[model samples]
Target: MGEKGEVSAVGASRAAESRKIINVVYLITALDITWIFLQLSVTPYLAKKLGFDTLWLGYLQTTVGVIQLLGGPVFGRFADLFGARTALSLACSSTVVFFLLLAVANHPAMLFIHKIPTVFMHVLPASQMVVTDLTEPEKRADALSKLGLCFGVGMIVGSMLGGHLNTRYGETFTACFGAVGNVFSLLLVLKFIPRTTKDPRTNTESENKSKSIFNLGEITRLMKFPGVTPTFLVKIVAGLPSGIFQVMFSVIAMEFFKLQPEQNGYMMAYLGIVQMVIQGGVLGPLTVRYSESSLLIMSIGLTSLVGLAQAYTQSVFWFCVIVIPMMFSLSVFNVITDSMLTKSVPSSDTGTMLGLSASVKNLLRTVGPTAGGYLYMNYGQSSIGLIQFLVNMVVFVYLLLRPLKRTEARKE
Candidate 1:
């Protein structure tokens, strides 16, 4: 009877811990929402104010991408070496300052300085790492889906609120909106996440043998594992279109559709709603029903088809209809792909691997803005759609031809 009581107490403790973690995820959604709000239109507004065009906007994104590519790994290593909570707290605190910089900057060039600090102090990867650390193996994908829902819901609120604010308040002052979310995220990190949870692998090793964050050899050795490389490539390729589109969307809507900031906000809100419904409520059950390989392949193929459908769509009504499948597929793909990658590596390296995942996306994102912007300017807005369609096709065909490699899974 005493043993059963002890087991019951343990179960209760775990349940309480899980609830706290989920609450942390909800707080993260606020941050994601604020971010989406700022990016929806404020970025382009600043660039145009500085006498820049789509190409210049692309340049800014490229610069951010380059910085993120390098800094992402460093932060990942920080989370691993120190702890996710420490890294996340620092990231949240850094974001508060970064937004302040954006809010006060007189010139567009100053935005680059803002992104420099952000390169090393990002919360998304760190936050995901936190959830990864707490979740069970079978439930990680579902847990990740909940994270995705936060992003989706945040997008809905952020985009709509951003539109309303941008229309009413103008650009520069509105930059501080995300800072509000940062305050809350920082508080949550300080209060809930543990100060340190050192990796056993590093602890077992000699202090001098611990790898440096700046060491190229360390990063190279990380990829030496069986499933890491291919998984990274798949995520990069599958995610590129969305990455490009994310930066380009506001610009495209403004130019092609002649949309007001509020209208653009509404469109993004609609997209967010679709993402929220699918990722938040439906992803877990669907994950149970299908293998990651099958779902990924199907989602990629259908997403390409949806891109093709969008290329031909001129009206907002039809565009709204198309957003459903696109959001569903992309959200599902992100969840499952992340699950696959995290399972590919041991627990100790989860932070590093997740950071690498962000780096690859950022690397591709560096080129995405410039290329996507130029294509939008010189070719046509529809051209961006065509490019996405083709890219998605390539990814789908490659995945279909190759057997999805599931390396020996080891839980941390």
Candidate 2:
């Protein structure tokens, strides 16, 4: 009886510790995302001040994308090897440097130089790794959806804060604010997040033998795992159009909508609010009621429809109204895909898989911006929606033709 009670005590203590770590992860994720949207709010004005044209802006994102493409898997492997706390520290440190450079940037060359540190900015992937580490397989989808809630909160606050500061002060002040926020994030990671114990499932001897950060062989081997390839392909195909739209959105706001910085901030905040409601209030119940495959298919279909609606909308009011379903679809789709990918791999490779996923999106960002810029310049904003509509429709049809295998599908 005494032995059983001691075991119960140990289990309870471990559970408490896991919950504490998860809560800290949520806090750090929210803070980091806040800094991101905050930086985004002022980047357009800074680009204009530096005399960047639309094509130049595309080139800027492409530069960061190229660096991240090389770094994503490395950082993911780093997390897998060293643990998420270490990876988060490195990412936060890079962000602080990036922001400081942005604050002092006076020319387009400086802007390009500043993005060099983005190679280590894998905060989101690392945080996702931490969550997957702690959560159970059956509850993973619901747990991951809460990250979207953090994202929404950060977006709402960060957008509003950045816009207010930039409008009231200037771009430099806004950049400095981001730098400070990330410094605090770094401190939180170091102080609050506990060092994770090695998973019993991990083969320490083999992992130690392959500790090189950028092992293409290892990444390739992981990709060959059952269900990984097709899921990754779907993520890339479905993500490309949205990725392009996101990278070029500031340009769209400035040129097409004629939005000033504060107005753009408010628009982002509105979108954030919708996302929060869906992820926080709506998605938890939906995940409980339906299978992930059903949710994935439904979200894709809805997103394709939203894309078609966005193609014809001319006024800001109509655009705002249309964005509600768009946010819901996007939030649902992202959570489901990430959950599925993590579950498909062994416990050891979660970070690496997420890193590969990040690399895929970064690859899209690298090419999508340049193409999106040219298309937006020549064909107007409607072309963006047209691409989204067409790509998502194809993907939706593909999913219908061949649904995910049982291995990939979440157990209800």
Candidate 3:
């Protein structure tokens, strides 16, 4: 009876810990809504005030991408070396600085200089690290997918609030609002997120051996893990087409769609609703029902179809209709890919791998805007969709021929 009681106590304790970690993940996810909120509320207006054209806007995104390309891996390593709480606090602090800079920027140089802090602004990756740390391998995809609920909520709330705030007040006021929100996020990190201890899954020897954040050699070694390289390559290649579109979306909305900040905000909210329904509600069951390889192949194929549809879209109504499948596919692809990468590596390296993933995405972002701008300026918006269609179709075929290995089934 005593032995059984002890076992029950341990199980209960673990269950409680799991609950606490999940709650923290949700809180972190919610706090990150501020980023999308600021983007919708103040960035567009501020860019216009600072004399940014579409190409200039692309330059701005490239600048951010360049910084994140460097920062993502470093911050991820920091999380591995230290803990999720410290990394999150650092990320939130950078966000606070970024908003403060945006609030006061009167020149293009100031706007450019403000991107410096983006090197550490990796709240989402750190949150993923936390989730990967605690979740069961099979459930990791579902748990990660659920983080989109916060994103969807932020999209709806942040977009609506940012639009309303900007319309009523001004871009500066909205910027201040974002700064305050980030400050609050930092406080939440410090207050709620626990400090790192020795997790059983942690490879203490490796941790002790490598404490440097800028260890490129160590970072490169992560790819050599059994299933990581192929999965990472797939994520980059498969994601590039949509990445370009997303990077240039603000410019497209303002130019082609003739949307004001308010209208764009509404559009984002609509996307959020779809994302919430698919990611928050549908993806959990799907992950349980299907293998990651099957889901990934389906998403890639669907994305190709959506790209073709987007190429011929003549109005916002049709664009909205097509984006339903687009969002569903992209959301599924991201969650599954992330889950697969985490499963490929040791638990101690989850943060680093996630950070590396973000870096690769940032790599795409760095080039996506410039490429998107050139295509949009020369060939027209239809070119962007056509490129997406062609690229995704090719990738889809490649993936079908050589399907991703099921990393989840492998023993660590």
Which model scores highest in lDDT?
2
RMSD (Cα, Å) of candidate 1?
2.3
Clashing pairs in 1: none
Over the stretch 95-191, how does candidate 2's per-residue lDDT look in tens digits?
9999999999998899999999999999999988988888888788888889899999999999999989999999899999999999999999999
Off-target runs (Cα >4 Å) in candidate 3 are: 201-203, 409-412
List candidate 1 stretches off by more than 4 Å: 197-211
Per-model CA lDDT versus the true structure:
0.77, 0.87, 0.84
* C-alpha TM-score for every candidate: 0.93, 0.96, 0.97
How much does candidate 2 score in TM-score? 0.96
**C-alpha root-mean-square deviation, each candidate:** 2.3, 2.0, 1.4
Count of clashing residue pairs in every prediction:
0, 0, 0
Model 3, poorest ten-residue lDDT window?
197-206
Instruction: Predict model 2's lDDT versus the native.
Output: 0.87
User: What is candidate 3's lDDT per residue for 83-168, written digit by digit as tens?
Assistant: 87788898899888988888888888888888898899899999888887877788889899988877787788788788878888
